[model samples]
Target chain A: MGAAKVSADHPGIDELFALLAYGEVAAFYRLTEEARMAPDLNGRINMALMAAAEMGHFELVSDALEQRGMHVQQAMAKYRSVLESYHAQTIPSTWEEALVKTYIGDALAADFYLEIAEGLPDEIADVVRGVLAETGHSQFVVEEIRAAVAASDQQRSRLALWARRLLGEAITQAQYVMAERDELVDLVLSGTNGLGQLTEFFEKVQRTHADRMAELGLA
Target chain B: MGAAKVSADHPGIDELFALLAYGEVAAFYRLTEEARMAPDLNGRINMALMAAAEMGHFELVSDALEQRGMHVQQAMAKYRSVLESYHAQTIPSTWEEALVKTYIGDALAADFYLEIAEGLPDEIADVVRGVLAETGHSQFVVEEIRAAVAASDQQRSRLALWARRLLGEAITQAQYVMAERDELVDLVLSGTNGLGQLTEFFEKVQRTHADRMAELGLA
Candidate 1:
């Protein structure tokens, strides 16, 4: 509806949605692989459910792009490399690491999107909310992490370090995107407090990540 | 209702659900991997949707077992090897082969279940129907196959032969299951025509397979 504003100073909704759509697709693939590596049946099933939810989120963002008459493939193509690079750099070698990676990465991504959602039009923000709401696997991850750490104190420190590594990689990727796409940064910051919000957004994301780590007994 | 019938002369409903549950779990994993092999984003997304549906079916059958006081994991453990062997023997090397495997395998499995459903009690049969009804990804597969064939005749023959290989493997696995679980085979065949329906069931499965092959221009 407000195409002019979207084009001029706002974060390009198409670009942001495209980035998120591809991210979800990549996550779905990685999570499904992680599900296969799960040590037990229920763990496998839980991860599969999470992977399914990611696909659902991808569909949501893809549909949003389509409603705006953007080609799904073309919109998604540009953002593919950044997300794939992130996944490649942070490949989880174990089920525990996979859980931590999914938990921290997903939580951080959700927070960033929520921040961006605040600046978006009501309809687009609604789509963001729909994508953000599918946290069904969060509790499952928390349970698995705690149970894992409970079995060995070594696992606790190992996973805590892993979480830190994941957060580092995530922040690196986020900064890479922001550096590369000034439009996305503007879209993200313009609604709340402009450039000043960047510090506040990272702080908020860090707080949530720490809270999630605590929930997983890594705090 | 009819616990005696279930225990004495008939295949236990628990065994049936257990078999179906494991099969769905196995399919979810295989399909998820197949989704990754998809050459394009849309194909990947479509396969992920089908994989998700399989997970949903797994949950449905798992829940049914739980409601009957059966341990879901325990119930599923018995049927694991047969399904695993089927998947192990038929790993698809390419995206087209994956599609053919999924399309033909899913259709055959659905037909077999439908035939078996006729002998089940109403409630259990309803569960079977619910699982059988999730062919939502069928049209997506058909479109992809036709598009591939129209683009290259070489792809058509390669896929057609792959479909035949998949069918042979499926029959081999089905026979293995029948040989291993006489109760399951009995459960499968005892419904409609008592013990005389084996030939008729295979004929039905073959007919549907032909129709699907024709739809893909492989017949």
Candidate 2:
């Protein structure tokens, strides 16, 4: 779980890559599913673009895993059931809800990964950085949510709840991952300044989530 | 309807571009829907890649429409109902069915568009050619179908029926589009050698479809 254990078959790094790689694939499909519920072609196309972006990111991480001699499917197997259940439980009921889920869910996931990336090797960190950087869909989501909320107080309140629910589900899934992948958890905790950084890490994610909510007029 | 009437407001070209652009968007959504039923991560990733390819092609055609001073949404509106009906009537019920539908349906549509492209202006023809050139997904479909058929006769028979149904529904939708868009029909007839070539065109498409089916072991 330290520099002494670092190798091509390092359990911590392998689990991290598997988690991130599978997460990207899951997001790709979920985004496509959400895109189907978009109210118009513009929204639909935007969602599709985001989905394609996720797929591109998935290919990057999966390629990284393959280069390490891990089969992508076998590497991804552990996370599949949990991720599927999380998505099933949190299925968006409307176009607006789907948009909110995608925006909030993706931002939170990105922040979590970015924090974890700080402790990873340069190669892995570089892939995470590249994916996090390609978040051009945020502006579109902000514009959409703001416009919908501006249309009515009822819409605003409904979406605020939706955002909260998205955050809750994401946190629950993150917790599940942490519980299941001890190696990955150890990697993140050790990679940070110390064990104390876990509290600081979560606080940072919360701050960003609140800032994002305020930006969308959901504060 | 003739060469003398071709201008900035040419109904034939406008309708053609509109249909083509909207068709790509529809296919993007349909491909995503089909991808969800994929049997494995590899298959899912492949379907997603195909969906993303359709989206890329959509942007190309939509950009062409914009260059001609037509708004994409407005251009696509005319074909919405007809294309929606086509998809609604031919929803695939399984992975094999989806694959067969995607392969046969896309090939038939490509043949139709290629025939019409011959009768279109250079700008529109170029867009059609680019879109048709992105048929890399066909080989994946062929391999998957052949593997399934080789595994069992029951699965092969089922997929063969699915392919025939997909073809039948596609032809029905094409007829519907022809009946609905008189301008597009006129454009094809006037731009091609004449009405006599329409029969020759369908024969060519049918020939290609038969060859594709044989290649997939569905003959």
lDDT of 2 by residue, A57-101 (tens): 777877878888888888888889888877898899988888888
TM-score of the A chain in candidate 1: the value is 0.92
**Which window of 10 residues has the lowest lDDT sum in candidate 2 chain A?**
A1-10
Off by over 4 Å in 1: A1-11, B1-11, B151-154
What C-alpha lDDT does candidate 2 achieve relative to the native structure?
0.80
Alpha-carbon local distance difference test for all models:
0.81, 0.80
For candidate 2, the per-residue lDDT at B104 reads 83
- Candidate 1's TM-score reads 0.91
- TM-score per candidate for chain A alone: 0.92, 0.91
What stretches of model 2 exceed 4 Å from their correct place? A1-10, B1-10
DockQ each candidate and list the results: 0.65, 0.56
What TM-score goes with each of the models?
A: 0.91, 0.90
- Clashing residue pairs in candidate 2 (N, C-alpha, C atoms within 3 angstroms): none
lDDT digits (tens) for residues A69-163 of candidate 1: 88988888888889989999988888899988888888888888887777666777888888877556689888888999999999999999999
